[model samples]
Target: MRLHRGGRLRWPTIGLAAVVGIGVLWHGRAAPALPTAEVKTGELVDFVELRGEVKAVKSVTLNAPSSTDGDLQIISILKNGTGVKTGENVVQLDTVKLQRTREQQQSDLKRAEAEIEGAQAQARLQEEQNRTELMQARYDVERARLDVQKQEILSAIEAGKTKLRLATAEQRAREAEQKLRSGRAAAAADIESKKQKRAKALFEVQRAQRGIESMTLKAPVDGMVTILPNWRGRFFGANAPEFKEGDRVWPGAPLVELPDLSAVRVAARVDEAERGQLSLGQTAVVRVDAVPDKEFTGTVSDISALAKIDFSTWPPPKNFDLALRVAQSDPRLRPGMSATARVAIDRVPGALLIPVAASFQKGGRTVSYVLRGARFEERTIEIARRNREQIAVARGLRAGEKVALRDPTEEASRR
Candidate 1:
């Protein structure tokens, strides 16, 4: 080795020593081990996921028979899950009071009919009496005229008296004619009043008959009988008792449901944020919570135009209801079954994609931390599109490149 004067190191050798010192400082602390994922070239799908329940495409709900007043107590009902045929008896109400009312009305109807007949007979008799009086009055008038004619041929004193007698007979005929007219008018009015009363009684009888018929409810179609909740029965819980024997049901209240199991669909609610993405005929994959292994294909059949408030919380979130038609129906698919659906809205094939968490922002530019050897190199990446869980890289990334899931500087400092 060559030495400089007075045992000092050579200038070139001193520069080399300084370089070694910097290298030692760079390797002093190890780089932090970070969670990483490789950028992959594959198809990327953006989908909206919704949670909901299975329902029937066609469902028939049977409401309580309409009543004028008070509630209808259930006397007997079919079993909750019993299969029923069309025109079969499904429910029977307590008709004891209705029966009593019907009997009373029937008696009233008979009395009304008897009154009508009696009134008709009296009207006929009154008509005959009036006709006889009218005829007698005409005869009296003719006899008075004959007496006046005789006055012209008799003696003077007798002729004067005969004229006076004719005058009195004519007066009596006028009074009889007035009586006949008044009697006929009074009898007709009395008959009309009685007929009106009879009509009222007949209406009551018919109404009572209809009420008795409404007490017995029958199945309108063939399907399984599913009992509906009695909303009035409970006061302090989300669930209410089902309609059964001895239960009091109100008018227009749902009593039972008949769901057509041949056609099934899922009824789900989409988040308000994703409401705009839903459209008719969009396809989806549905998975039932009860049957996890199978995935059913479905298409969107209906979507609500307006949002509804979710009442489960204070300041509730808005939600939109949607119906998905299942492509195929299975026997295991029953109404009220819980299910989840994933609806694909957009897709990209053979794209460079990475986990969304592996990307970060710096200096108003999108970036990703790449693991290179013992350290992480920060690279700026251009984003093409993104979803809830993944992001598609448009530039500055290639397939098989490793990206750090978190900030490398922060993790390294902790280490």
Candidate 2:
């Protein structure tokens, strides 16, 4: 039986309602996972751990010959991920056009040589003709002078005629000499022009031969061949095809890569604020996504001298690009794999460390929930060192004690 609406319920009824209310509250909220970790007695490392992507140290790309005369079409290519040896051909371009050009250039070169020879022969003949004409004119002038001398013994009319003949012969000799000089200069110019044409043809022939030789792309090292995307094609977005047979590629287009698997690296960028914390030769431990179980050791090989702006956020924060050269290469490590790296900067011996999430800021004090018996005991902690994922406690904590990874007070309030 139920009590009247305005009347108070008896103890049994009140007790049942309280029980139901508590059950409903417990059922409505599922318990949060209490991730716990023990404070460990070990050397505390002041480390900077960051997420990065794994990349090869020498991710070298094989590009089409930059000296090519024009665009080259691939005639043969190795399939993607094909294992290759040093000096092995990875891609072969169509040599038909280059070969034809070489042949044409050779022909032009031969023609120019022949033309030069003919020009020289004509020049020699012209020189001989000019010399003969000048010599004949001089001889006629001499003969006319002799006649004028003989006319000295004749009458005035005969002497006048002889003088006129000598003057006319002298004028003809002068004209012949001028013509010989002009003809020599013209012949020299013609020969020079033919020689220049021959030089140009020779250069073209050499260039064509080189272009033909460069059509076959070779791997520089012994590694697996990875076909690269066609630089000429933006036609396919993420599904863009690799440089394959029958693909038209321009000069200097990257076609393949013989990545050095034995030596790899993790390329990462950090915000500008962390730039000063990093330097060359620092030891870094990299854990790649593909090789989930293995840890790779590396050193800071390079650090960018300048900061690059990241426009992804407001205020355009700057980031520094750095490379971590893996000391030893593993076969499983590949470029473009996600990786996480921890770089140890400094260390403290015999220090107690705990999960960073265990600490909470309560009443301006850093406190953590220590699991004592069946309940959590809140104790203020003194942090001697701290990092991204861990914190070293100087006081208020001890080795071998389990701590709650999350705020226990917040969970109690929710309950």
Q: Can you write out model 1's per-residue Cα lDDT over 1-415, one digit (the tens) per residue?
A: 7665965656778899999999987865455777899999987889898989888899998877666478888898998778899989888888888888878888887887788789778878877887787777778778767877886688889878777777777777787778777877877787777778778878888888788777777888998887877777765535567888999888767888889988889998887889888799888989998888789999999999999987545577899989999887787776777898998898899889999999998989999988777777899999998888899999988888899999987776675
For model 1, the stretches where C-alpha displacement exceeds 4 angstroms are: 1-43, 135-153, 160-178, 233-237, 289-294, 313-315, 351-415
**Per-residue C-alpha lDDT of model 2 across residues 1-415, encoded as one tens digit per residue:** 8677755756778899999999888556543557889999887777777677766677678888987667889899998668888899888898898899999999999999999999999989988998999999999999998998897589999999989989999998999999899998998899899999999999999999888878888888888877776645544233355677888888888888778776778888877777788899999888888888888888888989999985545677789888888887777766667788887788888889998898999999999988876567899999998877788899999899999999877887887
TM-scores of all models?
0.68, 0.67
- Residue 372 of model 2 has an lDDT of 74
Clashes of 2: 0
Relative to the true structure, candidate 2 reaches a TM of: 0.67
